[model samples]
Target: MVIRAEDVRRSYGETVALDGVSFSVEAGEVFALIGPNGAGKTTLIRALTGTTDAEGTVELFGAPPTDVARHRIGLLPQEFSPAGRLTARELVAYYAGLYDESRDVDAVLSDVGLEDSAGTWYENLSGGQKRRACVGTALVNDPELLVLDEPTTGIDPTGRRDLWRLVERLADGGTTVLLTTHYMEEAEELADRVGLLADGRLVTLGSPGELVARHGGDSRLVVEAEDEMAASRALESAGYDLLPDERHVAVPVGPEEIPAVVEMLEAADVEYGGLVWRQPSLDDVYVALTGTDVTAGGDPIEGGRP
Candidate 1:
């Protein structure tokens, strides 16, 4: 395994960040740690990288997480702000200097799709470009393990896709990647396995398909109704389940059952904007495990970074 955590726990005064969390990552595997905004994802990353002292055992490449292993595992931190004074090339060169065995700075930049921006000043780069530059620095050491926290937090769709392709290529070339992000699609895209964290606990752990199969239902029916109240009455009467938030009613059905649902809705004259049919995903899995909307009801633990 490239990374391992056993019974990891972190506390700040009375606040508990991680509660006996344990997981492991294999060589060349892409794993994701996903949770709400303040559910201790960042804290866990800190512990794995040896930036924070938590009570538990964490190993990087079969050794304790310490300065000796720091050079072998790269980090693109949650609060990554590049030094404005340095250009892209200069910044990567600076990161390369930190490791005894480092890849060429230019090669690192090229690997992250930043070769054209090598001369661009850090402060002058766009948000996505800056993120790519940060990734370049993380890749400079060609570390065995890459830890990325919210790597595409504020990036546009195109830029986010570009970065994802970079990460995919890295993982395909035999680098182990561990990341945390609120974007479920990103996890769906890159994670070979996912661990869902909620309120300082690992609620679910499995491959996307496994989790979805275990917790997720069949095809979901999403209808935007003209009248929420009437729509609820009609759907519930016809044996379709409604989510707590009725703005969009979700029903579990197979492809053949879709027509049955549409038949009922049409019979009731339910005026809907549209009906969308889609497969179960990580979003549904998270909501099922947490019993709350993934984006709702989260306050940071005391002394915890958001």
Candidate 2:
């Protein structure tokens, strides 16, 4: 195991930042931690990296984080403030100089898609560019284990996909990755396994597909109608399994059953604005487990759970 944590606990005065969290990450596997704000993700990262003290055991390569060689690990905190006056190259090179052996500075910049912006001052770079620079700093050391906390927060869609490819390449090359992101798609795309944290607890842990299968409910056919009650009654009467909702009436149906549903609706003369087919995804699992709904981009909508 590249990482092993058992019953890890941490608190800050009145707030319980982490409540008995535990999980493991294997070598060359990409593991993602996902949850809402104040979900103790940063605390767990800190504990695993030995930057903060907490209860329970956390081992990296069978050794305590502090006992492990620093050159073997790379960490990018959620909030990093390198020297603003330093250019991107200078920032990455400064970190590279800390290790006895490191990847070439130019190569690191190119890997992060920042080669053209190498001379740009840290403060002058765009939001996405600054984030890329920080990622470059973490990669310059060429560590075996890489931990990234919200790595793509400020990146554009194209930049985010580029970073995802970079992560995929790193994992293919035998680097163990532990990342935390609000982006559900990021976790679904890159993670071999995902651990969900809420209120400082590990709510669920599994592969994305497994979680979606277990908690994502079912494949839903949503009928957007002006009269939801009538549409819901029509579907329920037709022997379709209905998923309760406040707005659109949703029916659990297989893809092949969609035409049958449409036929039934037409026979019953039901009026619907449109019909949408949605497959179970990590986003649905998040809502099912956390009692909150999140947008595709991972912004939480603060409402009662469905």
Candidate 3:
């Protein structure tokens, strides 16, 4: 394992930040830590990096996270602020000096698409530019393990796509990465395995497709009825689990039950606005497990960091 944590726990006064969390990251794989605000993603990251005190067994590259191990790990923290007076090139070079063996500073800058802004002062760059610079700093050491916390937040669509490509390239080159983000699309795009944390606990962990298959079953039947209350009552009477929304009522039903649903709607004269049948997605898996809208308020597990 490139990164390992066993029985990790932490607390701040009365609130428990992490509760016996355990997970591992295999070499050359992209592992994503996903959750909502206050889910302890940051807390766990801090513990793993040895930036905070906690009770756990943590190892990086087969040993404790000592100075040598720290040199082999690239960490892009969630809240990063560069010195306002330092130019991008200077900032990256300063970080490069921390590692025993560092990559070419120019190559690192170009890798993150920040070569053009090399001379720009850190505080003068745009938000996206600043984020890219931060990523560049992390990559300067060419570490074997990359630990990124919301690395793409505030980036434009183009920048976000570029960052995803960079992550893929890193993984393909045998670099193990442990990342945390609130964006499901980002997780789906880059992760080989995702660990969902909720309320400081691991709720689920699997590949994107595997998670959907395990937690989100078949497609749902969406019905927009004129009278949602009556339709919900009818669905309950029929023993179907009705998921209500302001615009429509969704029910889980097998393919054979589709005809019956249409008939019931017609008989009850419930005028539906539209209907859609589609395969389950990660959002469905989240709703099924967390009992909340993943698309609306975001994943509660990561604690709304991104």
| Clash pairs for candidate 2 | none
The residue ranges of model 1 lying beyond 4 angstroms of the native Cα positions read 236-246, 297-306
- Per-residue lDDT of 41 in model 3: 83
Model 3 clash tally?
A: 10
Give the alpha-carbon lDDT of every model: 0.85, 0.89, 0.83
- On TM-score, the stronger of 2 and 3 is 2
**Between which residue pairs do clashes occur in model 3?**
35-301, 35-302, 36-300, 36-301, 36-302, 36-303, 36-304, 37-303, 37-304, 38-303
**Model 1: per-residue Cα lDDT over 18-88, one tens digit each:** 99999999999999998887688989998998888999899888887884556778898877777898999
Model 1 — which ten-residue stretch has the worst lDDT?
Answer: 297-306
Distance (Å) between predicted and true CA of 294, model 2? 5.5
Q: Tens digits of per-residue lDDT for model 3 on 97-202?
A: 9878899999988999988999999999999999999999999988889999988999998999999999999999999999998788889899999988777788
Q: Give the C-alpha lDDT of model 3.
A: 0.83
If scored against the real structure, what TM-score would every candidate get?
Answer: 0.92, 0.92, 0.83
Model 2 misplaced regions, further than 4 Å: 294-306
lDDT of 2 by residue, 1-306 (tens): 999999999877666778999999999999999987667788889899998899999999999999999999999998888999999999999999999999999999999999999999999999999999999999998999999999998999999999999999999999999999889999999999999888788999999999999998989899998788788889989998778642688988888999999999989888999999999888788888888754322212111111
Q: How many clashes show up per model?
A: 0, 0, 10
Candidate 1: what lDDT?
0.85
